[model samples]
Structures are given as C-alpha cells and as structure tokens.
Target: MSGRIVVGVDGSEPALKALKWAAAQAALTGDSLEVVTSWEYPASWSTMMPGVPTEFDPEQLAKEILNASLEKALDPATAAAARRTVVGGNPAQALVDTAKGATLLVVGDRGYSGFKAAVLGSVSTNVTQHAPCPVVVVRGESAAS
Candidate 1:
C-alpha cells in the first residue's frame, strides 16, 4: 500500500465490521489505518435546540463514536495503532476528502435505510463514487462466507 487505509467509522454494526476488515487489511499491507467519523447537527439548529453548545457538540460526539468503535471493533493492538479523526460535516464527503492520498477508503453498507438516508444516499456509496483511491464496502463478516 502506498498510503494509509482510511476507514469510515460510526457507532453501527456495519461500521464496526468495516473497521475490523480495514484493520486486517492494514496489518497485512503494513499500512497505518485511520479511523474517521463525522457528525452534523440539524440544519435548523438555532430554532430546534436553542442551547446547541451546552446541549451537544458535533465534533465531540464524532470523536466519541470513533473512539467507541475503535475500542469495540478492533483488537487492542490494532486500535492503539490506528489514528482517530473526528470532524463536523457530511460523513460521505468527509471520508472522500480524507482519502486524498490514501491507499484505500473503507465504509460499511448501512443496514438501515431510512427516509433521510434514502434522500441523502449512503456514505459507502458516496465514497465509492468519489474517493480518489480504491473503496471497499464491507457488507458482511467475510468475503467467502
């Protein structure tokens, strides 16, 4: 691998699966793995949750999600070696941009597809479509299972 393996991570089962897979890939290829997560508040935040800052922080939540997923999904060694990235923005676009010089971009095929997801599209699909490097959508436990 020429560059890092950048993997999108959220507090979801599929995202955990992607993280595990990406960790394995990084281990085999001798590349560093980057665990990334992004979150955005509601568009009408001012009118919605007037106490936005005191109520919640998007960047902090993203960091928590990334850290939780890293601890839960990967082994101690892998989790310790991987870097964490937390940002506030569209998950898909954030991941795509992070893949600038990455060897590969990995994301999970979300199991839940709600109305908002249907409208905005999936992060995995968007990254696959926009990533400068190869993208892997981890759909299941194993490729040959």
Candidate 2:
C-alpha cells in the first residue's frame, strides 16, 4: 500500500545518504517522502555565562539544515515533491513519532557526533528500537562500497 516514507535529516553526510536512499525507495514504492528535522535547547543554555547574547533559535536552524540537506540529497523537482517538517524536541523521539503510520522510517548509521568506530548513532539506534514502522539505517560509503 502507498504510504509515507519518513526520513531524518541533520545536515550530515550520513543523513544525506539516508535521504537519497529514502527518496529512491519512495520512488520505487510509490510512497511519499517526509523529511524531518528536530531541535532542542541545550541543557546548559539557561546556565550560560552572564551577558552572553541568547538570540539563538534552534528551531530555525533545524529548518535551515533540513532545507540544505534536501538540496544536497535530491534534485530540485524531487526535493520540492517531498514534505518537510521541523519539530521541537529530541531528534530520536521526533523521528519515531513522525514515522507512525508511515510505510518506513529511514536514518543514517551515525549523525553529527559519535565515536569513529561506532556502528550507529544514538538517534538511529533509538529509532530502530522504538519506531512504529520498518527502519533503514544507511551506513557510510565504506559499507555502501
């Protein structure tokens, strides 16, 4: 049955790979693509040094990252065809929630941070365990090649 294919994009190389993979899969399955990104204030934000300008907008940054990731991952027509969402919360939880009722959920093996030898990022690991639908964690070029 045709449904949404949700993918998390964080402006990282691995995320870009996952986006591309998800787009191709959606094309084959006739599923619509939903590109998602999330943002949350740092725990230390409230405790930052006094006089530090606190004009940062995590949600806006998340939107920008999602837009850039879509451009890098898909052609203009394909990117425009996909739905984009920017949420405010933990990345893993956002992805899992967005994947509900979706045909599949796609993520990168790793995100912005993690040990070089780690097989999967925290978000990818969490979503795989909790997502309501099937999950695809695309590995880096090494694994793809």
Candidate 3:
C-alpha cells in the first residue's frame, strides 16, 4: 500500500478534522491526498412545501459540500493540493471503493447531526470494518465533555 492517502468528508467538524489530518499525513509521507464525498438520489419525491428546497442535484451538491469542507477545514494551500472526488453512491461504499488502492483511509468517527446514537452504523464504522486499506477515524470531543 502506501500509495495514496484517502479521506472521506461530509463537511462535519469531525470530518473536517480528518481531512486536515489526512492532508498533513500525506505531506509527511509524500503520498498523494484524495478527498472523497458521496451523494445519493433523494429517497423521496413527495411534493415539497413552499419553504422546502426541492431542486435536486446530487452531484453538484456533493461537489459543493466537499469543496466547502476542504476550504473550511484545511489551509488554502493544503486544500488546493488535495484532490477531490464527488461520487454518487453510499458514502461508506464510495469511500471504500475509492480507497481500494490507497495506503490509508481516513474518516470521521462521527457524522450527520440528525441522530443522537447513529454513530455505530455510520460511514466511519463501515469503512473501518470494510476498507481495503488501514483506516484512521478522527472524532471530535463531545460538547458536553
């Protein structure tokens, strides 16, 4: 392995931390850095309420989120140096597939703010269990701590 350093980001604080850490690691190891983000088609096509946003563009949204994550998390030079990929699929699967030939796969220990106890089945967990390369998970401190 030790080819590329792959990181999965979804714009969360923990994810941003992972991205920054991965970029640093890549610089130290002289490995290429690849940041990945995944998106899926909307699950529901139900009529949208007036205030709800219904214009769906999964690819575009994924790219924006990924870029924003990098820009917000890493220094400008670091963010610009890291290659980004926005793919359409399950986040876990996409990350795993993208990191297939990578030396290390990095992801956040936490994700989506929608649920309180959804950490176990998240992208980090899935990638840790199934990624072809070694995985590193970065977790943010609890707010209550």
lDDT of each: 0.82, 0.92, 0.84
State which candidate has the highest lDDT: 2
TM-score of 1: 0.84
Candidate 2 per-residue lDDT over residues 1-145, each given as its tens digit: 6999999999999999999999999999999999999998867886864565678677888989999999888999999999999999999999999998999999998888957676788999999999999999999657556
Better of 1 and 3 by TM-score: 3
Q: What's model 1's overall lDDT?
A: 0.82
lDDT (10s digit) by residue, model 3, range 32-111: 99999998864654543244556756689889999999889888988888898988889999999998889999998887
Q: What is residue 86's positional error in candidate 3, in angstroms?
A: 0.5
Looking at model 3, report the run of 10 residues with the lowest lDDT sum.
44-53
Ranking by lDDT: 2, 3, 1
Q: Which has the better lDDT: candidate 1, or candidate 3?
A: 3
User: By TM-score, highest first, what's the ranking?
Assistant: 2, 3, 1
Off by over 4 Å in 2: 46-52, 143-145
Best by TM-score: 2
Return whichever of 1 and 2 wins on lDDT. Answer: 2
Candidate 2's displacement at residue 139, Å, is 0.4
